[model samples]
Target: MVSQSAFAFICCLSLLLTFAHCKTLKRDVKALNEIKASLGWRVVFAWVGDDPCGDGDLPPWSGVTCSSQGDYRVVTELELYAVSIVGPFPTAVTNLLDLTRLDLHNNKLTCPIPTEIGRLKRLRTLNLRWNKLQDVIPPEIGELKRLTNLYLSFNNFKWEIPKELANLPELRYLYLHENRFTGKIPAELGNLPNLRHLDVSNNHLVGTIRELIRVEGSFPSLRNLYLNNNYLTGGIPAQLANLTNLEILYLSYNKLSGTIPSGLVHISKLTYLYLTNTSKALGLMERARLSLFKHFPYQAEYHLVPYLGRPLLRTNHSATLPHLTSSRPNMWRFSLWRFFTR
Candidate 1:
């Protein structure tokens, strides 16, 4: 049996250890409070406590995810997707240096992303899609060396796509479509070695696709590339056929003018191709026509037909074609069949 003084001392030490191991770091708690206050009264009701990290099993707050780091807990993820969060980007998030993912998509968040976002060096995914956020993307996003996925689509963002994004060495998926961006597509984007999917469609981008082609070994691992609904001119680069892993290509609704490249037929993995409303001068070369039929003899047929007061060449491959139709005249629609697979 222990003396009263020794028993009391043991109890006190156990209580101290419990309190130390259960509480979130003071800085992280402060940041969480600031984020809640910045988000106005629409924040989650569970955000009511001084200990947002809870008792180490789950976070007390709804959107916050915390992890243990020695004696304290730290915020690691904040996924408030489609929560109707109103107001600007929460600037306090930069304080969470250990954050690996930040998703605030499908909100009413407005204004430009703060440059302090670069402070989250451990971030691997940053998704801000389907928001009202406007203004040019900050170049500091390039500082996230571990970023693998970036989705900024369906926003009101304007101006040129930042070329600094090329600095992200591990980036894989880059989606900037359905925005109001203007200026030339950054050719530096083509040099991303690990990039798999790139979509810049439905913007005001101008200039030729030749810049991307000039970079040797561009888009080596690319599988899906979307450059539709822009003001791009010049011929389609035949070097695009070099993307052996490419499965889908969208270059429609642009001002491109040139004959279709016959080498595209050699891309055996290409399952879907779109070239609608490209230009009035765009046509399929005779070699390209023969190549298409050679690869897809049963389903591929090219012929000119009168439609919408213009002659249009349509290729029908019903087996693999999606239910897509274009009313615009002077367009070439090719529904290539995935007849061969690698």
Candidate 2:
């Protein structure tokens, strides 16, 4: 049998090895820091310091989820959309390696989206909406074969939708709204068999919305269709009626003047119909908005947003406004999952 001193030495070695491994992950975080730093996105993501992963028996970090067993390697999902963080996206994000979802919306972040983002092989949902982002979307983004939902709305993007985006076999929700994109919606989008929500609203998109609608089968999963506020001409395709699952339709504020398709208004699941600037009606002023917001009872995953620059709703205006137009509180959010599978 080993002497007690020898046993203690072995234990010390094992502890040292474990500590070294944990420190390695810190290197990964620092790599991310560098990427986020240069791009200015570190400003929005700076809350990383507030993370409580080291707390005993608990790990609470906003927009982050972790695996339940073993060392609990980060099967992380970062959903910080509309969190008001600003700055550029960095190549270091691909370093997270285990990340499945990344949502960064409504921040003031500016710069070209790095092509390296496509290197995130495990990524699932990627939403970068309502930021000041400008530049061409990298065709390399198609490399995200596992990608499901992709939102790139309200930025200053000006490029043809890459034909490669259709290669994302798992793609479901695709939003390219309110940008400067100027091109025909590629017929290849129809190749995305699992596509559900397709919104290309408020862009400079031109030409007929294409004939892929006649492909003889319904995109059973397809739901909301938002093609509003564009220069797209030509009649609304009757083939659109075949999509039995079609729901919200926003065709207002476009050059398309054809009669509304007969079955459209009556689609069984169709709800929250929006038209020219109708969604702008959803922005309620301060007191009125806060009234709808019940204080979050438990600890929040994300830090509380400051009142400064937060949208305020006027109580008087809310009373007069049509309640039908308002969005559900934090409609873009999904439930937090405590148990993650790696």
Candidate 3:
């Protein structure tokens, strides 16, 4: 039984409240501006206007997204992948408290990652690959409890990988390849329950590679493991057989010794196996040849490259296992028939 004037007044107040709530905050705009300034002009362009989170139909900026936050709009995502941006990783990004995904990979960015990156607690994905970043990864990165995908590969990083990386429980993919990391692979890496892909290849890593197998029931979900071209010395642990879900394994160009554990042959899921240049790797190669030849599909590839001082096949290299070493397409055809018929 309200009057028309009273009802209209209430409706007007609701419209005013909605208008105030949809506007972008001044702090978010400031953070975005700082990030652009850090990247310089050459890489980031078309950011001339001040209203980044505009009230228009299109997005405010080139690589920015805005979302509602109480009575204000805030930046939720900032993606600048392969945009040829130069300069160091922007520290001002930490100011965007609502940011969930930050992709600045495949650019010419230089300098070490900022330590304040740990402040982005809500971040789930952070990609900074193919850059010129160097120095050791900041231990503070472990603070990203919500991080799921972390890519820092193809950089100039040196020094031992921080053990703190194991602190990220939700981490699934970790790529730190083609860097200058030294020291034993951290045993703590096995602590990651959800880890599926781990690649630390082509680095100067030293010490035995058994640390990854030390933890019981570790890496139960691991699918791909690549630790090739390191200075690793020691026997390949039989525990690797426990990773029943393992699909691709690369442990080449190392100084490892001891007979290849027969348990590895039982891993039915393993398809791509590369054990080139490791001591006594031929033992497993020869033993598993029959099983692999009979069980695996044509798509599976096994490379047992001969190293110096120990040549598995010499002089008659062209004749030895001609079917196995032939053109890849032909080999796949041969292997397919051999596996099904036998």
Which structure among the candidates has the greatest lDDT?
1
Against the true structure, candidate 2 reaches a TM-score of 0.63
Candidate 1 residue lDDT tens string, 1-342: 999999999999986566547668888889888888778666667676667777554446888888767777788998989878988888998998999999999999999999999999999999999999999999999999999999999999999999999899899999999999999888888888899999999999999888766777888889999999899989888888888888889887787776667677667777667766555445544433444445432233233332234333443413222232333222233632221111
Ranking by TM-score: 1, 3, 2
Better of 1 and 3 by lDDT: 1
Task: Estimate every model's Cα lDDT from 0 to 1.
Answer: 0.78, 0.61, 0.76
Q: Residue 79's C-alpha lDDT in candidate 1?
A: 90
What value does the lDDT take at residue 247 in candidate 1? 82
**Candidate with the larger TM-score of 2 and 3:** 3
> Global CA lDDT of candidate 2, please?
0.61
RMSD of each: 8.6, 14.7, 7.5
Which ten-residue region of model 3 has the weakest summed lDDT? 333-342
Off-target runs (Cα >4 Å) in candidate 1 are 1-20, 55-59, 284-292, 295-342
User: 36-114, model 3: which lDDT tens digit per residue?
Assistant: 7777776557676665676444347887877777878888889888888877788888888788899888998778898
**Which lDDT tens digits does candidate 2 get at residues 210-299?**
454657574657887877777766666767767778766666555553333444433555544443322122223333224322222221
Model 2 misplaced regions, further than 4 Å? 1-27, 35-72, 79-86, 210-214, 257-342
